[model samples]
Target: MFLADAGVPTVSWNLLADLQEMWAYPFMVNAFRAGAIVSVVCAVVGWFMVLRRQTFAGHTLSVAAFPGASLAILLGVSTSLGYFGFCVAAALLIAALGRKGRDAGAEESAVTGTVQAFALASGYLFISLYKGLLEGPTALLFGSFLGITTGQVTLLAIVGAVLLAVLALIGRPLLFATVDPEVAAGRGVPVRLLSTVFLVLLGAATAEASQITGTLLVFALMVIPAATAQQLTARPGRSLALAVLIGFASCWLGLIAAYYQPYPLGFFVTTIAFTGYVLAHLGRAVHDALGRSRPRGRTPLSIGGAA
Candidate 1:
């Protein structure tokens, strides 16, 4: 009945009316606002993470947010506090343990894996210790947009703004360091400090995104869009813009789908994001194949004929 009234098209189509209906509900409005902010922040931060090959570290920080949220519930505090605290601590810890330079890839992975393991275990422990309802556990893992408050939306916007501002300030130097650490270091770029700062920023972004997509599905918001953009473009600025655009589209579409369907927002968001990524890869593969098949330079006989 509501869907019909919203002009969602059972047998007929009404795009403007459908959009107006979706925007009519306050909760949906808040959801869209929150989703937009989360998408942009995650896209920007995830772009740099992909460039630096720090997906593992991003995953670890996201996982660590689970323990933080659970612990916050146990202590009866705001879950956001827990998310930020745990993620930032984990980021600093990872930075401290993996400071042996970029060449120490194995060591960094080991450190990240260890942190992820402990964080998961600790999250379960917190869950076990909680005597209240188990619903919070599910929400922490899968996420919900139905009951999102205006305050939460405002908070998301604030955090997104700050993260973007910081990224703008250090984006160039960080890109330089990520591309060639040895050369960047030789040029006095404060490679280690920038790395540490970037990790902390990643943690912050992970924590913020977890609030929307949940800890388990953080990659949906952070990784997929950025990876898709990278697959589609080699230019950094264009890639970043494309990543943000993809993220925004995924979030909006996912929210609309979740509004009509009885499913977790994270599931919809992740599926949409994954679909975009797959399409990007397919397009790239087709383009590469076509390029290879096209003959480059004229053959000797053709050149002689032309002469």
Candidate 2:
């Protein structure tokens, strides 16, 4: 009966009802816009993250942001500010502690793990300090996209633009460093400074994406598209473009799906991103099977990040 009655009026009713309702809401518009911007930032930075094997860092930073967000909630302040604060602190800590490790990846993972535990504990303590006094921080942790405001959208736009610009300007040098740190240093590239700056930007993006997708799922944007792009290609520029496209497509599609379905948008968006990655990997496997597979030498170290 539902299918038999499905006509112009039926389709129009869904459009005019769910479609119109979501579009008519300002928060939805802001969340969608913010998500798009954050997706771009995440995609670009993610290329370097994967290249440098910093996905661990990205994940750690996302989890480390909890205490700051909780503290902000306790103080009745913007959770984004708290997230940024925590990320910056954690970023610096990771950079400092990982400076001399033979395995930067292992060191980073350790630091991130420590921060994650402490941040989670602190968040709970902060929540207890103000028991029953405010809205639950779980929404911030799990994301409250429908609660995004115009001010947040503007902030996301500004930060995202600046991050993208820096990535563009620093792309070549950053890549050089990531691929071969010894060679980059021999060529007088400020590898240390670049690494610090890159980590900071990654932190910022992590904070922003966390606000959109929540801490638990922020890695979907920060890691998935970039990882998918890497599986698809070894070329840097092409990978960046592909990752951005994938990220944006996932976000927009997920948003639309969430608008109609009775589920959280982040879950849908991450599922879409993960599916894209799986499909891309499968496609690449088919491609390799069809072609003569020559190793592209040792996989070059990434300057910024992808996968």
Candidate 3:
């Protein structure tokens, strides 16, 4: 009884009804659950990464996951094991090679770039060697929300909780070290130890996010939200909270859009995150310009007194 019906509902399209329909499926529920954990963890760690200028290091760790996953597939093992193992190893290597001292920036960049190059090559090599009709190549690069299991969701939750707890424990000293490493070290803060711990946490976060966004697009979750939040605020606490909220909104909206559309989930997520970042930048620019345009002082009162 619907005109030109193409499986359209007879009742008016309602937002609540649409949400209820989306939540009716078990897979969607699992997807949302996993996504929530991933978003929170990535946002928190990513805020630190941004503050410390560690985006390149984070990207290298993410690239490391590709080789890990591909090697896991080649060895017929659980991909999660490979993801965590290789990423952690790569993090250690980077931390060791890039010690905290003068010229540390150059050393870190060189080491991270080398690791990323080798990781990419290794991933492709594994792919080429993978016989027996390997599938989900696209899923490994981009991601899919359809096949997320309850076990995977539980694993994500446990890992995310541990990471959050660790971050909370070290949050104060870590912030001090990040803001002024030399001063913090002089004041008895173990800057080197904190650096090592942070890198390891970043690696774990990259691996965890790769499960949902794949290795290539992991930055979509980590970098974009944090960068957008930083653009909007200078206060550390507010920026961190904003980043988490932005990540959560992006993930949920991306999931819903992917559910109704024919594209990959990663595409929607990355696009939405990128859009938020762009908007934030624009808003900041406008705010700055307006502030500049406004006069500063009591010039009118001086003129009236003179008159």
Candidate 4:
């Protein structure tokens, strides 16, 4: 069975030779290009999402991508269309329906959870409605690199660039709003508009990530690397850069591993990210235990947050 599932005929002794062989194919080249774009975009957006404590909303958007792709398969259209369209629409709905005020977080969670449940049901329904076997989009549920094209790579690059530019334009205020919304509002920041805009951007990022990591495992890129980086460093810039590095490494290594073996790509990606997170957590714990010579300023878990 191991032999049956191998993508390459044999393991090679030479690392550079194996890498050269992996990159020799146009499909592999496109996969790398797309993965690079997705990794950077998702990493940046995910860092802010984590800081804002909006991971539940991000998870909902990722889940929403599934039904979108499912409907596209039923309509015989591009799955990318379904992925983008549904995620954004669901985000708008969540933003609109979720209550505002002191209880906003609790209300938003309820709305996000409801949308996630409905999205899952709709995806299954779309799958069941297809008369023939749903082969194309189904392969993407667990992630695959098959049929990635230069055009798709170009599209991903354009989307990634746009996301980064928009984020740059609003990074400072968004950070203020995220860490202390009340104070940000008192300082004349448009907290509500920023929240809505961030949610939409998050949905777009989630959709983009789904193309590489798939609908079910999109959080592997969207959350794990950012969370791991936050665990290691509290500084926003360092954490953001570290998240991108972690995400990029995981994406490239997972692609290489999947190229050598025929196992599902999402499994490799998620496992690598998860392992990094575990290691970071352990290191943080050890550092906390060994330091007691002088009193150092504590890094707050979050604003007014306890361990």
Alpha-carbon local distance difference test for all models: 0.90, 0.82, 0.90, 0.89
Shift in Å, residue 130, candidate 3: 1.4
lDDT of 2: 0.82
Every model's TM-score: 0.93, 0.86, 0.93, 0.92
Best by TM-score: 3
Worst 10 residues of 2 by lDDT: 1-10
**Model 4 scores what on Cα lDDT?**
0.89
What residue runs in model 2 are displaced by over 4 Å at the alpha carbon? 1-21, 101-103, 133-137, 292-307
Question: When superposed on Cα atoms, how far off is each prediction in RMSD?
Answer: 2.9, 8.7, 3.7, 6.3
Backbone-clash count (model 1): 0
Candidate 3 residues 1-307, lDDT tens each? 1111324323336989988877887888999999999999999999999999999999999999988988998999988888889999999999998856898888899999999999999988998888763565777888778878899898889989999999999999999999999999999999999999999999999999998988889999999999999999999999999999999999999988887766788999999999999999999999999999978875888879989
Name the better of 2 and 3 by lDDT: 3
Scored against the true structure, residue 224 in model 2 reaches a CA lDDT of: 96
The TM-score obtained by model 4 is: 0.92
- Please count the clashing residue pairs in each candidate, in the order shown: 0, 10, 0, 0
